[model samples]
Target: MSERLTSVPGLLYGGDYNPEQWPEEVWEQDVKLMREAGVTMVTVGVFSWAGLQPGPDTWDFGWLDRLMDLLHAHGIAVDLATATASPPAWLVRAHPEILPVTADGVRLEFGSRQHYCPSSKAYGQAAVRLTRKLAERYGRHPALALWHIHNEYGDHVTECFCPRSAAHFRDWLREKYGTVDALNHAWGTAFWSQRYGTYDEIEPPRTAPGPVNPTQLLDWRRFCSDALLALHRAERDVLTATSPDIPATTNFMSMMRELDYWRWAEHEDLVSDDAYPDPADPRAHVNASMNYDLMRSLKRGRPWLLMEQAPSAVSWRPVNVPKKPGLQRLWSLQAVARGADGIMYFQWRASRAGAEKYHSALLPHRGTASRGWRETVRFGAELARIAEVAGSRVTAPVAVLLDWDSWWALEGADHPSARMRWPDLMRPWYAALHARGITADFVPPHADLTGYRAVLAPNLHLVRSADARRLTSYVRAGGHLVVGPFSGVVDEHDHLHDGGAPGPLREVLGLSVDEFWPVPDADAVPLASGASATLWSEWIETAGAETVDTYAAGPLAGQPAVTRHAYGSGIARYLSCHLPDHIGDVLDAALAEAGVTACVPVPEGVEATVRTGADASYLFLLNHTDRPVAVDADGTDLLTGAPVRGAVRLPPLGAAVLRRPHSPDSLDSPDPANSPDPLGDNRS
Candidate 1:
């Protein structure tokens, strides 16, 4: 963590504040209200591009200057935006080519946010111009805490098929393959007659015939992510040159499919995620926690910021549901307990009129008298008491492998079936681990695996040679591993591996697949342990592995469904079939074999997570159940500040933070400048 983050007095509360939306009088009232509600900082100028730059080459700073000074006067820090999230009407009118083109070649009209194409030279220059201006103007300002770059990239437009982007994509392809022939070989263009004579012949895989070349699609995804990351890097360089002190970052939509965050994460000084879990799902917290862990893992366990979450209800969903009285508090702390240093919401005061008028905020449209505002105040005050947790980190001995390339390629149209999803399969395993009170970090294929005692890989279908070798080395080095079925079936180029499926891992997995059964037309296939599986079932034969589970009935009757292979001091558990949401019994046995155990067992729907501080580990027990749960643990409960005996009781939607002794000082992170973290020491 940087001093810029830890220098704050407490958890950084508050969020995107639109002082421009209200009158000057209301601005003062909002500041007072924010301070009263324990808001330490606010992100300003997120959507103020149209307002800040009314015309081409025009700049307006009168209203914004006063607001910044006013916020500083009130002792509130500022996460200032360059207001380049959306290009102004005048700029888009002047440079119409900056508008992004859809896959069908339709130019997206202006008025909506993020309409500019990332590869447009004009758009890139204009964005940097505004950003440099902001850095120069507010570099040393008292309230300037951090620099907020352009809002979420590729959220609306993942890739633009415009000529500019196409040219950029071709350039990227040339850089990767060195020659058009090499690219053809990698893409396996033999069957499709896609042999390109020149790099320029390639275009963004846009609206192509029958799903497009899977390799080209994956490359297009890579290009889109790189193009936007290039923009961020350009602005970051400008900011660093002008400011020299302020750290730069952008908010990431945790689970957004566009833009490979695994690659984008390296450019950030510290990671921040905007999460909005569905209230309709009873187990929304599990999904939220998974995203949090992924965000924290982006920086390799560095403290991250909860950039934007709904204070109460979100407006964009089909049906807006208000969070129950204490749900907001429960969710916000959920992020913190999982290694987030700060907690901020989408907005401060609710908008009086706009597209997001219905979106909840610290001070809602109903004003401070409402339940939303009261809960916001209560959560903020609670944050004030726990300021020390800002630099602390949660220690987990398990890692869930996450690969963006694999995710993109695994669900390609040319696959056996499109019924499977990478996140869908990974979520169940993560939830099973989380249920056991064993928090996990999300690791990329290339990340160091020494710290983790075990690694769970749900579906790593698109395995690169180097990465496959890395996994093999990890297993040989005494690291327990769990491999799901249908993995390692394809090389990095999205082509089928030679000979058969489960290519490089055929040796490591100690099994070979002769054929794959698609689970009764995408329905569940019964297993011997009473567990059911969907998506795929591989007819397998083990070389030197032991069968743990088998199919009860089917043509592949009594076949190995799950296998265990011992290598070095570790054991590899391979599930030769897809699994349903419920795999508790199997997961429990796997975890136990790896010597991983939960801090304490809780009733269903209750979560247990541990964050390590300087002198002790803070155990967070969250009760998501409607009924009260009995918790058994030792330590001082932070919520009540009381001692807990043998079995303490927690009400529904309640939480208890337990402080217990552990290895001292858990604050450690790989510096942003360090390309690969070599200090792979496990904290606590």
Candidate 2:
């Protein structure tokens, strides 16, 4: 098996296929129609636990075996599912304790998918049994390209506060801390007389009197995430042992609040994600862009697959809006622009029954004659035109740090303000970078920062002492660092740093935050730089740091609102309030200091991203505005084969791929009538 989906000629384009839902004869027709749309692969058996194993003692693989063989005959590869996403009724009845419990102490009955407790021994045994059975059966199946693990780990049952979970939590704590004393000290258990005499005294943080211990709550989240990850590891190891050549993966949700993806990524051979940006959201592309970038960065800039995206309107939202004409194609290419190797959807054909019956699929209920089917064919054809993009990567000079530990600890129930949303607070920085046409890789806090010219630290509330040292070293060694508000407040253990805010980084930042005020009811305050700030504000005293911006007309009027401190060969800047409207100016100044600038100047709403192949570089231009905008880009438009020299007009919501010629300064003549061979060299 190939490491990536690029084993074939072009970018892999296909989605989930459930043959059990239709007649056996319809499977052939499904394969024929799919091949017509240029699909290369399909993920089967995502939610087929009940269908695959109708009973604990009884097994049925006839339907799936025939389907796989049928797809292989059609030259379509497979991303086979383990059929463990949803347990069958017989298994649940045998071991009722496998059902999960809510934090409110309700034992959820098994009526939906993902109802089993992740930490249940009985459930684990069943998962292992199912995985081994699938691996032995499909170990060398020619159609098998990838192994899809249990679907969406935390989709339904996020956390299980049952007795089984409690036991697992205790075991995990003992392993992580090694000793009870170490655990107590790290948790600062003395705060609320919450110190446990022994490990058995500790229980998963459930309903508590008043506010729960912040340490206990944070640990519970970690434990819950670990439980899910352990399940994936067990199943993944089984498949790898059976067929070491085949890569294993599960569809990860980008913004899932549970099951921290950063921790789960190491277990995956390659990265894959299910992206469902609400069509109703006007800023959906911005959200999708970040997700695509994050997914690519998970494996250090390796190409990933867009496992699930809607071809039309989704049925879940309040007012499920259909995708605007050309929007799906634009979004699909947008993912490719950001380093997605394959484009796939949730279902191959629309569901006629079940929970997601109304979810959009490549083949809608109207079948081959529908607009959804037409768009699928058109997009598939476009992918066929740019096969060189596969195995390539998108690299940038800036990194926006994404720390899951910080997110887990920062906005606990009892903080300066529980309303301080870490995710929302981090969005402005991302949006600012996007608006400037500067692509940034999402990295962990301790990742190598030497490659990036500038690093943005936003709401990094949980930084260990070692992490703080590494960050200071990055800045002192001549890299621009932008520290967002409420950063560096606590250590890795969720305990506040002894002295003040921003802890070990206070000196490098040349400032100290003595007080934090939760002013949710306060209005936006004016910055001396002529911009306004909102939501969060902090009081700080500078220690030899220059005040680049200050509060203009608030209670702390004329005080230092934003400060910059030069340390060694670099500069460290701090923002006391949430990023303001003048953020572009602030970032541009840092970017200029770091010897970097926007990739190229383009009108607002036109997103730009570049993917560099081994022998050529491909630039993707997307026009997101309402009207066609002229771009000062010079390259052969791969879509039309036209050599663009001075300016080209891009239709609204339209996309174009430009493969740059060898000479950066010269625009080579183009063959407008011919499509570039996807496997050929970069030529015009």
Candidate 3:
């Protein structure tokens, strides 16, 4: 077995292949082209359940068998598909109860993927049977490398409101609190004269548009996530029984809402995800990078697979924008640099017809000589060249803490600051770190942060008691901590703690928020740079903590928009307002004072990142803009196959990997201005 196909520290290539869609003649040609492109693995049968199991008892594995055999004969490893994404029409028609009923009381038609009710007994039985059948047949196959469960499990058009799902929701509530009284107390159902006397009286939260209760809607979201996790666990148990050796996983959509990934990761053998961001979007890098970090942290720093990336444009979004030249390669390496062990795209070949005909692939409609094909070849060759060297490398000395409990709590609150939006507040801090090439993991709040020198907690609305203790201890031990404005407002149950703003973190952060000034719009209070903070919402005040910066010109001019607190040997900084470029610079300078250095020393528009291992270090320098950038060379240039003695310029959308000699003290290396570039590319 090749290490590239089955081990850590070796990159795996290739992606979703639908050889069954094309003629047998094209299959051989596809294999030859894949080999030439350095492709090593293929994912099969993701959307083929409708074609495979047409009836409850009927299964046509002939095509799958032949497909696997053909791939195996070519020495291509197979990520065998479970064919559970879309159930067949017969199953839906036979058991109409399996259909999902939306929140609006409309019964969804069985037309797309993820349409089956996860809580339905019929669906579970059928799914388990199909999974067992597939596993029993392919469990002993020599070509099987991994098991890819339902494709992008929660990215579908249905939300279940059927009676079965409602009953499951009730049962889930029972398990969560062990009694209806406890549940009623947590939900505060008595407020609107909505009290449940019996289990049957409780229903999944479904409300029409207008004057709805936020608590009810929040509980419904929580219940639905739990109900779906049960389905995942059931399927996982079936596969684990049949083929215990093979790893099983479902692809996650980055930063998705419906499914609780932290809980889902507990049942998966490995984490995998699909990433598709708009090419023209300015926040594309942060969006993709945050998702990669979230996936990596889900398994506690374990490597994950980039299961489905767009080789070009995706067809589903209203606007299908193509990735610019070198963009795909940059994003692929971004995943690997973050901690991905494998890189693959959605479709290996362009579909001749259907919903995704416009999706990009290695071999476009014009065949192998086109721009898409050439870019794929170049990316593949580069991946193969560094496949062995870049495997299993980890990056960064700092990590950011992210918690699902906090996410749920923030959204679950009835009195949540209308001004606070979680994603918007978190993105800027994440982007600031990414621009400097720092690799930060998104660990849960409960994760141990003792190893990290700095911890950034953005919009930490929910603060558990234990987490507060841990954070206090971390800061007291000389570690730096950053807390965003709306942090520490609620407890685990989404209720105000009655102490003050920030609850338990109030004492640790040495700040108590007395009032919040909600800006009417981005123009209401602009940054010092004269740019409006587009998504900024609330500006808070610290009653006791020392003010670091105030609004430059506004009605609340001298109010504390940013504060700092001294806690033992360390310091805690609280950001109260949405900081545009000017305020962001002040915050960045504050972080520098706390002993955190920029991951890369380049100017804006150029993205810098570093990945390291015990024996090697790799620095990534990328130009994110359309125009070229002149960068000072620092080490051996892996992409250009040359080293520069001083300043070097990179073309538009260019990227390079600089390999530096490893040292045990690399993490503690002094300022770059004092240390010479060991590879003779120093710049004065």
Best by lDDT: 2
Which stretches in model 3 have alpha-carbon errors above 4 Å?
1-5, 208-213, 412-419, 526-544, 551-557, 580-583, 633-636, 640-649, 663-684
Residues 528-579 of candidate 2: C-alpha lDDT, one tens digit per residue: 7888888778888899789999888867788888888999899999988886
Global lDDT for candidate 3?
A: 0.73
Of 2 and 3, the candidate ranking higher by TM-score? 2
- TM-score, candidate number 1: 0.95
Q: lDDT of model 3 at residue 334?
A: 77
lDDT of each: 0.83, 0.84, 0.73
Residue-level lDDT of model 1, residues 407-502, one tens digit each, is 888878856777768988888898888777887888888777876778899889888777777778888888888888788888878888886767
- In candidate 1, stretches whose alpha carbon ends up further than 4 angstroms from where it belongs are 1-6, 520-522, 661-684
Compose the digit string of candidate 3's lDDT tens values, residues 167-285: 88788778877877887777677777767777778877676545455555666667777767776777778888898887888888988867777778878778888999789797797
User: For every candidate structure, what is the RMSD over all alpha carbons to the true structure, in angstroms?
Assistant: 3.1, 5.3, 5.7
* TM-score, structure 2 vs. true: 0.95
